[model samples]
Target: MVERCKDAGITILPSAGPVAEMFNGKKIASSTRARDLKEGQYPAAVYVPRADTVERFLAPQSTSATAPSRAPHAILI
Candidate 1:
């Protein structure tokens, strides 16, 4: 996503977070994280894009939405 944005001349900035060290790569299109599954923990990733570059995506209202924290294999960057 970052690459696509940058390729299109968008300025992308990595947002400050606890995992600053992982944010080292300029080609990093998303941030990865460890998550728990039914049997164990494993790594997963969340995609991040420059806020100014992406088009608006309307999502369904998550009335039955589980909390983001419950995702065993995906976490926010």
Candidate 2:
């Protein structure tokens, strides 16, 4: 996935959180110990893939020229 993103000119920033350092590569998993945020924290970060990259990854074998894309779901901290 990292190689594919790089090939498509997508930049993957460092994963954030306590165990983030363990994932040296572009992909990582995250979890929260708290049930939810304290209250004031906004969406500090969001992961949105590039349109073309999403299209390519999702519709590689698609014969149709168009693929419907929707806004990515946002996760609150």
Candidate 3:
């Protein structure tokens, strides 16, 4: 799915706090949806590129990435 996203020219920004580091950071992570699928998915971990190597990556992304508890209807994508 991630390969497909890249092939389709889709920029898959991380959806969760820990995963956001992948695009430009050393951590490998994923969205909550991915975590829920862990039982069915084989690889629990993923490889993410470091932010130091990329210019498009966002910094302190986790802070702004969070959706408010009151605004549960907000769409992250």
lDDT (C-alpha) at residue 33 in model 2: 23
Residue 19 of model 2, lDDT score: 30
Q: After superposition, how far is residue 15 of candidate 1 from its true place, in Å?
A: 10
Error in Å for residue 50 of model 3:
2.9
Error of 3 at 59 (Å): 25
The residue pairs that clash in candidate 1, if any, are: none
Candidate 2 weakest ten by summed lDDT: 31-40
- Could you say which candidate leads in TM-score? 1
lDDT of 3 at 75: 21
Name the top lDDT candidate: 3
55 in model 2: Cα distance from truth in Å?
23
lDDT winner, 1 or 3? 3
Report the C-alpha lDDT of model 1 over 1-77, residue by residue, as the tens digit.
Answer: 23223322333333434231233343323233311122124332323433422123323343443544332342223
Candidate 2 lDDT over residue span 4-49, tens digit each: 2333233334334333211235333333221111112443233432
Global lDDT of model 3: 0.32
Candidate 2 stretches greater than 4 Å from native: 1-4, 18-45, 48-77
